[model samples]
Target: MIHKLKKRRGIPAGPLRVIGSRAQRPGPAVETLEIVLKCDSFGTVEAVTTLLGKIGGREVEIKVIHSGVGDVTKNDILMALTGSRLVAGFNVGLAPRLEQWTKEHGVEVRLYNIVYTLAEDLGALARSLIQTEPEERILGRAKVIATFKSSRGSIIAGCEVLDGVLAHGRNFRVVKAMGPVFTSRIESLQVEKRPVREVRAGQQAGLKVTGFVDVRVGDYIECFDPPVGRRSSAWSPRGAVLRFDENA
Candidate 1:
């Protein structure tokens, strides 16, 4: 977006109104964003593309798949849907249906009036493409020493914590012969006959996990936390609205 430049070169100014509001975008994958660029003039197109090409900082990339010196066209929108699903412009406008199409099909339209703002926004979007997905982390591991039946005859795995404490209410994966059997959570943990919240490493305990009925003497219990949330971030949309006689 480069403001303070009034030379239109040979482009005509048309009836313009703000088009397309943003829709919910999914978490970007770890890849480059190939976008489409449309501008009011050839000069602006080259300048905007050059500005975006320098972004993404090696961790991600901004690749312009299509470039044209005209209003966004239907072909541009169709081209965007191939993968990048994005269209950007300078001094352009859009039609009503194009706005709906973007919201419906998850296409992004970015129209910039300032070149600096365009570079900054696309840079941030590129960085956001670096994946920070949710992940499960191991909390503890325990080795099953014996398999026993309770007074009511429900089988329980008597175990000694190999390392890390077996925590209550945390999810656990049952493993045996170096392979996973099933996943369940600690339903009960007991040292002797009294229920406890956790048992530490080097300690003997009887544990019951739901959905882990086929307990074996040599099976292992791996406790882990569920997948965590994404990293914190916030960004506001800049001059993204476009109004023109035609839409892509």
Candidate 2:
């Protein structure tokens, strides 16, 4: 998720009283003070919430205007700040359509090119975006996935690699009606555990995920790769990588 601070000019400053005295001291004229939390996935909401809480503890008044997945539309931006006495600025993904919309609306919206899977960079970006106060805290977004396999109760899963890479020996989630039912690791990966490095989109593979029982067919397995120490290397078996969707 991306957090941003927006300020505007030309609004009346509210009443303020000087400390330990009856005289009135002028508060900084705040024609506009709006904060926006933007993200491309629902999972980012938690991280954004935590960041806001930390900022608030330091006396920054921030309200979440909108939080959801998908591209940020002009309507979403307008709705988020509508009826407020102050104008708002925006920080969103670098999408051309969004940029055009911002230009038409005449609101200054900053675009950030966030590299996926890097937690430290994301945290730093969030901090830089907020100018009111500074805090030394590190926060990151978590990765999640769902696994599907046979009904034999073994770790052999015929799964689709969505969003991010699913590698051998990595921890994953077995989604059930009661939320995440179990946490397991990929014991082995194969076109069937024949020793593969990574799996990508559009290719079905058998994964021997460990630590879960009753892993029925069609059950989803979710996995998370923390945003630390993630390598930028390409997945091997170059030909296999090509088979996956470039957009995935």
Candidate 3:
């Protein structure tokens, strides 16, 4: 659970006031956040609620203010203002002049485009309040062979896996002659025109990266496993070793 500040319109911003009073002490644990939710489509609302349920479990609470047709009404804003809670909207928008009203009332309003991002934001807040430690592990390394443009206009790198394995969805860092230059996740991977989950050592594959686009030949790409938080542990390989015959 996360704690959100409650603000009164006339009061000056100072120390946090718990449950609408300046004298009350904060709770030992942030019980739960009551969020006013609005979404443009019923499907999106359902998806967001499902994801939030999965992520927050029983630690969060949501009140759907508007779903499927309407924009956030003044009543919704008034509800949040009087209740001293947050308002989250997906694809739906706030009515004109509501932004200023929220500011005046000191209510927080968050807007999101993607459902995953919306859930991620709230989940991150909760995790932060709980304090989670994440560990990182390297997975593989590949040498860039060539660069090309995909039909969708994304830059693709033709690479040969030199060590371990390069898998789809793995985080990667691009290293040039000087030093490491860029870092991001692999968007797509293909082996000989066929999509593949992974490319093992000594195999060549095409890689589409998400953020860092300026990839060139001879650059090194290092793949790493997703960082795991202390609360959730998942199996990950340590390393793969290859030895060449000395006589050869």
Highest-lDDT candidate: 1
Please report, in order, the local distance difference test score of every candidate based on alpha carbons: 0.70, 0.43, 0.63
Please provide, for model 3 over 1-248, each residue's C-alpha lDDT reduced to its tens digit, 9 standing for 90 to 100.
12223233433232212222112224443324445566776666667766665564333333333333345555555555444256667766667777666656666667776666777766665444443357677799999999988655467899999999888877888998999888887778998889999999999999986566778999999998767647533211121111122233
Q: Candidate 2: lDDT of 157?
A: 61
Candidate 2: tens digits of C-alpha lDDT, residues 89-155: 2223433465555445544443233323223322333343333432322111122233455456664
- RMSD of candidate 1 to the truth, in angstroms, is 10.5
Whole-model lDDT, model 3: 0.63
Question: Candidate 1 residues 162-242, lDDT tens each?
Answer: 988898898888898969988877888999978999988899898875554688888898999988778545332221344
Q: Deviation in angstroms for 1 in model 1?
A: 29
Q: Which run of 10 residues does model 1 get worst, by summed lDDT?
A: 15-24
Ranking, lDDT, top scorer first: 1, 3, 2
Clashing pairs in 3: none
Query: Local error of candidate 1 at 118, Å?
Result: 6.0
Ranking by TM-score: 1, 3, 2
- Of 1 and 3, the candidate ahead on TM-score is 1
Candidate 3: stretches off by over 4 Å: 1-135, 151-153, 230-248
